[model samples]
Target chain A: MDLNQTIRCIVKLGGAAITCKHELEKINEENLETVSSQLRQAMNLGSCSNKVIGMDWSKRDGVLDISSSLADFDDQRQFTVDFSRFVVVHGAGSFGHFQASKSGVHKGGLSQPLVKAGFVATRISVTTLNLEIVRALAREGIPSIGMSPYACGWSTSERNVASADLSGVTKAIDSGFIPVLHGDAVFDDRLGCTILSGDVIIRHLAEHLRPEYVVFLTDVSGVYDRPPTDPNAVLLREIAVDEDGKWSVVKPTPQSMNMQVEITVAAHDTTGGMVTKISEAALIAKLGIDVYIVNAATIHSLKALRGELRHNIPDDWLGTVIRFSR
Target chain B: MDLNQTIRCIVKLGGAAITCKHELEKINEENLETVSSQLRQAMNLGSCSNKVIGMDWSKRDGVLDISSSLADFDDQRQFTVDFSRFVVVHGAGSFGHFQASKSGVHKGGLSQPLVKAGFVATRISVTTLNLEIVRALAREGIPSIGMSPYACGWSTSERNVASADLSGVTKAIDSGFIPVLHGDAVFDDRLGCTILSGDVIIRHLAEHLRPEYVVFLTDVSGVYDRPPTDPNAVLLREIAVDEDGKWSVVKPTPQSMNMQVEITVAAHDTTGGMVTKISEAALIAKLGIDVYIVNAATIHSLKALRGELRHNIPDDWLGTVIRFSR
Candidate 1:
């Protein structure tokens, strides 16, 4: 529990797990509390180094009112720039896609991050959801900031924000805090703007932080030989990142890209399946750093990999531990 | 001014006309008061029946909260029920489309209306807008009701409503109150659902009432011989509702159905415009009713029509009052 420990792991959480596939209305405080406790434990597990748990916002509330955003953060004097030790790249589902689409308006139209402005009412709801997340995080003593790609000016020449000042995350981490980020749409060089998935975000971070290991905690048990949907699907406990990425990889359907991450853990009940994370892991593992893919239920595995938990035990065999030879 | 003596007109107010479109903000009260005053003067000038101004809502603050709807009717005990004198067919812009597309789920995707379980967020917005409109009408001392085609059903086989059980509207109007309706997608027998417009509500009413003179009002000046933007355009003072429906006909594009109903009376505007009024006029005018097309600004014209302020008699036109036969 020493605060002076050097951090070893820089874990990026997928939106599905953090937002609980958005099933619990808001952040699913029960799950968050549990995840929060695990993250805290992992952070303190090792006297070696303090780990940073980053977030890839699972969803965003599009209907943010200046008053509400201000009121929600006003007394505490919190603003859009107040993310924790983690830097973030969040999504706009919380903003207005609902309203924009309702009006048959897809502003960019099949372009990067596919958004329209007509869904004003839906944005209103998303705004509520976004506030709920903020409130829950705040209550947990976790300071979180909310951002949307449509409202924020983070884009690359090809996309919107290439390296979107993930500085919010880095600063949070540097300040001895847990920086939380989320899956987002970033300006892209290739597609004008592409979804910066939680896994993709880790890929982005790997280029910058060069951390020893990147872990993805999700609801699913782990990666599978085939789609987990099938009754006969078997769990693939472990695999070399490069070996599995090329010969075996699954593409995401039109509805989602999260499921297409190279190699990561997944929840059985969430929208994005293991196939998506597998893709993300493969992409990050290529950077020569190791990745620990595990169910959020057992985040201790993350701490174990960080040399924090000194146990050699592999519980559940329900997770994957990925590493690089470089 | 005696309340009952006020000339009655059903003004279908567009959500855009009254709201700060993207900001989701209400129109300021000072401006609203002026608009309401102009409405009163217009009422005094017109021979039309008691006016019932219906608000076409774009958003609802809450289901139980009807504060915005009751903006103008501060004098009486405002009553709100899901009852209507007019079968208002309202467009569900900023509520349905973007949310549907965002969820990658469509219930009644254009091919029909309310066909799917749909997104929770989209449904909330739709319901909220309905409440706002209904609530506004009630506040104005106008007995009002909210109606959605999903609840009533549509004639999918013919891309229309075979029969809208508009018992609510009938009861309201029969009680000597104005019935209001708007554009809306309804459950259909064929396409599974179809969108019925507010104009059609008037058309159906015409089939029943068959008034001697029907009035049409809207945002723009009356229909013109050429596009209004053209320099040589001439205002179309008289529109012939003929067998072919060549004149007084408006069509809907994917972007907007409002175009067909944009005609209004010129400066010196009269009562406000009802977009589908022209189409309704076409349907009823064919039955021998003379429909007057005027803008809300033409106050003097309304006074002349009401036999209040006399129109100046031109010396050259004194003995030239020859009636043209249709």
Candidate 2:
């Protein structure tokens, strides 16, 4: 079941992006459908990356049209991959955050005996959500297997994943089935028990599996400066790690003041919020892997992430790209 | 959540005991209800070991009657434990056995790459059964937390449980919630994946937790001299490990010809049948713990195991007892 070779991308469905985090145990079905549909289209594209090697479409007089070079390829015929080689990891969202926050399961370390109930409750919540998402994907004609990280994930004394048996995951991917995993309560050597966030899991997986791309489908369009809520807040389209390993945001200057920031402020997140996501993404970026934080609220955003709507390039996409400069 | 001291018993609901193993995905609701009701009754009997130290009832001509000795104790009152310190383990039965057997998951070793689908299929089957049992227990007013062994169970290269984290299980018990676990597809170092039987899981748990009693509720009355299916089979009421640590069963002789064999022949059991169960129980019995194998088709058997009906001891009970002689 080893899939380290074929899988080129890892896409994560943030809990807040798929479920109504403020509502108890509610799933945002519309957003979920959009995400699933996009994944299907991307998988159908067959070995296509967002690199945009050759121009297939051109724009003239503000009108986009297919170029003569596109005549050789049938645009409507979907290309199939050797296999759909992508792993789907999801956040706990409302299913886990409430119980984990209430019981401190996410905080880690030794806890009071009563907190044990919280761990069980949180597990039930998240696993239930995992099943629902898996079922939905199955309805969309995608064969997905739902698994709890607790089933094979282990944590170290420091409460980070020490050894994770990903054979099952790799096997599922190799067999052309999507392996769906979610945040779960895992045993820790030092902490007794703790919550393993989906964000952290995706990063750990990328490091080991070496996927070429990692996409985080979130509620917000992308990472914003100053929490996005400020009137003057602006979206940072491209963020990269400098030679010194410091993060820098590509900003519009006097050379391009006409460009408007397209991102809105991030809503409140119980699971470390957007700040934590960025920091985790940065670490993956240092590995020379591309990470995208894109909103799935609109179909256009999905297209951008799938590399299907590449005529506009970075300008047409509503997301933030985090990568390391060669 | 520490329960190393509080929990004194471990009860396992064999898949054959609670579900129709011959039928696919069918649960024996009647048997399940009886088992749950009896467990509820046992939990209500606080500090009451099988010893029945202070009599709550007296018998007159094969009839059970409340005695004057129980006048001080409220007959209607259900005394709760400081904590409901017991763990309930269940087998996968039809849900897992079919796929595991077909995939050779129970056969412990490296497998063909194609067996990966079988692993995922088996997980879905078992976890579905686990959720069903959890829901039933919840209906019986038992706060049972459902967990898969894959969540915390690890196996050696030989496929035996190498390192298992029972902290959450212990915590669940210490918090007064029944920790319900079931056989599952777990990652193995030697085998890419293997089946962790519920029978094996119970033994591993007892070794770590050192519970005072272990009750294996099965479809049959108890262990027999030969396969219960044989016509001349006789129930072995009491089995114990001898000086050399070999298992031996008690049988009636000419001098005790008046004694009657109380167990009936065991029905079909795909999970290694009753013989495997007895072997596992014998190992636990050698550790100074009492193990009971009783039929769950009747409420009386459950009551007998719970010590609620204890007039005739081993002689009156319709089951086999495995213990170590001092």
Candidate 3:
């Protein structure tokens, strides 16, 4: 397969979306199942039709109603879709964050026994979760292979990805398999070792694979103007990046003069939180590939994954779209 | 930690020793547990003492009796042993051989979907076993990390190992972690993809790491003059390789002129069987590293692993010793 034509999208599963952030090494089984099922449906892995199934569109509150556009089609219709053109990247979430923060693994000092032990412990946790996700995909008939960066010479220098051998990933995708990567502990030239977040991995993959679009599946609806827990917090529906790599709000006109936003990082999160994700998304936007951030808890995320969130803006779509302005 | 001073041994776990070769993906849990316990004891990961305690050496047949030499020591006295200096390489066994053979994965034709699917399936099986083994080691308080060759750019060309990045293995050992690698389906430059056996992996590691010794844990006692099941077959107690890489029976005193023997490969074995192992062991012996082959089902293997089978070849030891004659 010509890789450039075969590669289509990159999906990032936020740590909190599939894992219980408050509990150590705990998986959010319900959300994971939902996401896996949606992925299967989107990929058309097993006996899936392109036609929309029975739905009570009016009941889905606070989303765009598109019943009129699909009124002509029946559920039996089938269509062709490039099902094997995407990759899955997941966050460490409850799996490795606790151990990483406790050992300060992101700030590497391998000489210490405690730090070395922590690094092993962290890999054990994250790889265990990676296998679980791979199994989940396998259950849905998606040939997903767990590709860990640490095992494949992915390293950073001063917290930036300096080297990564991506042949395995490309080979897997070329052979009709989905390569699942994740945030992992990796060697760093300057720091000795550090945590390479899935956000950064996604951006790196986008730069190399040139995916048509990127999707971020988070626990919340989308990026918020402030702490998501605050009662006054409002979702930023659209973001735009300029030629100079600057980001500006394109929807929900700012009521205040300053566009600076506050994003809080969880205590256990060794890698940066929402702020890092947005920054990475902006970088991807600079490549002219639109990025979508959606709540994995809702069906709207599935819509985004199915390539339905593009085109003209819909008032009912509950997510944020970041794209290049020029 | 100084890597040169720390690396002490390399162990290869034959596929038949840890899995049911006749069955599909069936692990020999009992043997695996025994091996894990022995590894823990050798590494001293838990509260284990170096002193031999409460032995009825006279009752044990076929191995050299060492009760007299060890009589001076009491069980209370503990001496230090460098327990963090070994790497493990295991074969695919029943886990991957069937799929690999069925798909002809070793022949390597990537353009075919069946070959690609088989490659992924074979990895799933082998990595599943790797995780189980790692978990088993973890239960023994051993910090074991699963390092897959395919995921890390270990490849072959024309069925010979062409490229393998070993920094992960060295780094793991340097940091006091045991890296567990396995025979895997790796990309082949000439064939497209092929099975890289544990034997070859061990040789590669031995050439680079220069361990003190190498051990091969198999299902049978050791190398035999012919098929092990034959009633007239006898084990080759000691074999020596000369400066020119020629091997000759050192202890058995061959009675026959022609020493060529026959060995059988199980129907499911995609990679070469005992023949390949012996060839690899001979290569390591040519490097001046002694190689020991013993049955994993017996305690003699543990003695070899614990560094007790080096001197005074005892008639009771049920294993084969391969060494250089120079």
Chain B alone vs. reference chain B, TM-score for every model: 0.55, 0.79, 0.84
Please provide, for model 3 over A1-326, each residue's C-alpha lDDT reduced to its tens digit, 9 standing for 90 to 100. 23745577799988899998886677798999889878867766444454322211111222423243234434313322225578999998888876687668899986553455457667877887887787666544466778889887799998999998887788778756788999998888898889999999999999998887899999889877766676776788888999998888877776652444532323213343666677789999999898999999587898888777667667899999999999
What digit string (tens of lDDT, one per residue) describes model 2 on residues B1-326? 35546566788998988888777667788988888777766765655532211111112233433232223433323322233567889987666676566557655443342244345556666776787677566444455677777655445456688668776577556545677888887767676667888899999988888886888888878776556676776767877776555766554442453333323223423434666777788889888878888887565566654654333454466788888765
TM-score of every model versus the real structure: 0.38, 0.69, 0.80
Candidate 3 residues lying further than 4 Å off, grouped into runs, are: A1-6, A22-26, A40-83, A256-272, B1-6, B20-26, B43-83, B256-272
Docking class of 2: incorrect
True lDDT of residue A94, candidate 2: 70
* Candidate 3, residue A165: how far the Cα is off, in Å: 2.3
True contacts kept of each: 0.00, 0.08, 0.21
Q: What is the TM-score of chain A in candidate 2?
A: 0.80
Cα deviation in Å at residue A193, candidate 1? 5.7
TM-score of chain B of 3: 0.84
User: Judged by DockQ, which candidate is best?
Assistant: 3
Which of candidates 1 and 2 is the stronger one according to DockQ? Answer: 2
Question: What docking tier does model 3 reach?
Answer: incorrect
Q: For residue A261, what is the lDDT in candidate 2?
A: 31
